[model samples]
Target: MNILRRAAHAVLDLEKARCEKTVKLFRKLGLYRRILESTGTEPKIAAEIEAQMLSIMEEGILDQHTLCSRFVRGELAFVEFVQQWKVWYAEYCSWCDRVALDAFRQAA
Candidate 1:
């Protein structure tokens, strides 16, 4: 299936803006799974990859929520919160890309 190449291409094509909403993020993840499933990846392997991606997405959301909570509590200035969010989002995207690549390679 050339899983590694497919994964890399999909990750590269991912649109950060399109994934802003939680529902959209979930849909994006589902697309990833579908991409694998369509390529004849084993069901177990596809599920494992989806699990890994979901776990990473969950962690990112939790961290983002914590940041928002802190802002609401007046623990951070709006500017500071935005700066932190930018950094956090960048790291999250990088981690997502890495996980997708690694997961697909392992599956292959």
Candidate 2:
């Protein structure tokens, strides 16, 4: 297979493994519960996570390309990651806009 195709499959496999690891972690420690408890049962933790996620994506193309080459290329399912990332980005942007507007209204 070509490099790209091989790389893509490797990524998928890695993602699958990561998913399994995540599930195991959840089973052992309840990752969601821990996050909720740490964040004080507020949805703000979700916002914080999302914001950090978005910030990571804001890195330049070179940075992103390096990430794809080094980590995502063989660790993530490109199609699935792209799909989920777009959805998350949309939600995050919407939430950020709302937050900004709220702050503006309060300040004005």
Candidate 3:
């Protein structure tokens, strides 16, 4: 029981660390501000992207490697990011819903 508790704590700590790291990356890369600034033409997309960004920060599961590469190379445009993130965010939401439903079913 002690060992199990320690393992669970470690996993939670790791997740917290990852989430903090991701948030730091987002700040360092100026992603949030840039996205906000660039989405003036599409308010709905802007809102969705903001929500997805928050979810990504919380989940710490986004593919940071690709995003970092594009950001570093100065090739990631607002339009491109929006389009890609929209699809990714939608899929992520769907997966979350499915997982929740599965858990409820199991509990029931």
Q: Which candidate leads in TM-score?
A: 1
lDDT score at residue 91, model 3, on the 0-100 scale: 77
The predicted structure with the larger TM-score, 2 or 3, is: 3
Q: Compared with the true structure, what per-residue lDDT tens digits does model 1 show for residues 4-63?
A: 545544543353233446645665668656877899987777777787877786676567
- lDDT per residue for candidate 2 within 1-108, as digits (tens), equals 467767775776676566556555554554544564475544554444444434433432233344455444455577766765677567666866775455335434
Provide TM-scores for the models.
0.64, 0.33, 0.41
Residue pairs clashing, model 2: 11-74, 11-75
Off by over 4 Å in 2: 1-73
Q: lDDT, candidate 1, residue 4?
A: 59
CA RMSD per model (angstroms): 13.9, 10.4, 16.8
Best first by TM-score, ranked: 1, 3, 2
Number of clashes in model 2? 2
Q: Following a full C-alpha superposition, what root-mean-square deviation does model 1 have from the true structure?
A: 13.9
Over 4 Å off, model 3:
1-60
